[model samples]
Target: MFIYQKLRDSILKRQLAPGNQLVESVISDKLNVGRTPIRGAIRKLAEEGLVNVIPNRGAFVIQPTKEEIVQAYEIRMELEQLAARLAVPYMDETDYEHMQRLCDEEGETIQSSDFRAYLQVNKDFHMTYIRKCANMFLIEFAERMIDQTNIYLMLYEMVFFHTSPQTAPGAAEHRELIQIFRDRNEELAGMKVRSHIANAMKSLQIDNIQFSNLGDIF
Candidate 1:
């Protein structure tokens, strides 16, 4: 489990990079484990859409298409908006403070050019609020969608406009979003979340020159 998490984290952080091949024997040797465990881990990642297993080509990181990226963000926009609406009445001071801390941490990561760390912290911050809705079904649904979208983001990040290396603006957006939540302004929160997703999609469309063919992957 630890090896799986470490490998997944490395992929998400881009430390492994897109299109990188994952050779089970090599990984087993490097991690000082048997091929059985490494193979199991790779299979798990493949199921999660993190790794692609070609019939004869071996395992590699999945590269997302432009359409897939757009679709993923669109789903995220809807789900997150719904989550914010559901969570507004349930949010307390503790949630607000924790969100603020997550924003600060994300800011630090972004400033340090640690995009992977920022992505993880950003997801954590969002999940923290979404979990407060206390609706298991909705929470699970939103989490899955976010997971898919994050994978898309990792795969096609360059397709979007250059993400700012600076953490201040991203942190500011997080802070503002939190303030909206604190005010119990569900409508504004939904709008902000939608806009944030839309901006991200727009950036990707303008920057990345490649378009993913959904049919090819499916």
Candidate 2:
């Protein structure tokens, strides 16, 4: 999984921007590994929807459209709202304590500006509620939508990084959501879940304009 990890980390760190060519030979030389592992890594990335492999052309990082990104968040808003509402009734005292610990960890990671740690804890924070949802189908479906949005954000987050301190506020929002859950205010918690998505979408967007740099969807 070395090649896979390298490619994923490169994309996450923005060393390889969206739509950057992932040539097998180039990767093999760059990573000083064999072509077999490089191809395997590319295949894995393609399977994960992080890269698109054209039949005749080589693999390139997947760059979803801004419209696609926004639409994904819209769907995520509904899914997360449902999750929050359902998760509140099932969660126990242990769950709340565990969530509180994660929120604390998230705050520390954000303060350190460890983007990777922040992203990891962010997923953990949502999945904590998502896993408690009554509906298995809803959980799986929500995860897929979240993954799609995350791929875009991971690669195209310079606009977000340059503007506000996005990570810290998001950690604070998780704490807010957790508190709402603790209060057993299902309806309000659901509203807050949707608001979280809305705020994330707005924060992700460029203030004045954004370039729709997406090329052909290979």
Candidate 3:
């Protein structure tokens, strides 16, 4: 358990760092653990996409690339667009208040520059509606994909979008999304949600998504 936590946190915190080799003998020596559990933990990390285990060659940490980040955001945009439309009929005052609080908390976290906290609040904000949309299939599908894609999103934000989360298209954008939910304007809400998602990537200079002109990456 300790070895597992240590290795997982090292990847998340990037202590072990990306592309670094995870030599079991070295880890066993460093953490004073046996090879059995160390191997077990590496397999788990590999399953999560945090580490890529190569046969004969040892595990290496994931280095989230630009293409991977774009793919993840694309997947999220589709899920959230559907979720935005589905959540309208189900939303009540309680849901509104909860979402409002999350938006506010997200702003506060941005102000404080608590990156982890801001990310957590942001995920919570999205998941709140996602879980309430009452479509178990959509909910489960989003959860599974987001769980994997979120790691790449974190890498992108940390590496590329830095303090933007504190400024324009961050908290203000979140507030607008909340209002869209309040309006229960399903089509408009979906459009706005899609725009919000694309805009985030636009900041990174990746403006080549032609829905009509589909490509290989699709």
* Candidate 1 per-residue C-alpha lDDT over 35-87 given as tens digits, one digit per residue, 9 for 90 to 100: 77777888999998999999888988776666777777888899888888888
lDDT of each: 0.75, 0.76, 0.71
- Candidate closer to the true structure by TM-score (higher is better), 1 or 3: 3
Candidate 2 at 95: error in angstroms? 1.6
lDDT digits (tens) for residues 1-218 of candidate 2: 98788777776766666777887766666667788887888999899898999999989888677788888999999998999899999998888888889888776665666766767777778888988999999999998888777776676554344433444566667778878988999999899999987877766642233322212111
Candidates sorted on TM-score, descending: 2, 3, 1
For model 3, the stretches where C-alpha displacement exceeds 4 angstroms are: 159-168, 202-218
The number of the candidate with the highest TM-score is 2
Q: What does candidate 3's lDDT look like per residue over 22-122, in tens digits? A: 77777776666699998898888888788898888878877667777778778878987898889888988898899889988877777676766776887
Better of 2 and 3 by lDDT: 2
lDDT of 1 at 141: 87
Q: Distance (Å) between predicted and true CA of 44, model 2?
A: 1.5
- In what order do the candidates fall by lDDT, top score first? 2, 1, 3
Q: Among these predicted structures, which one has the highest lDDT?
A: 2
TM-score of each: 0.73, 0.83, 0.79
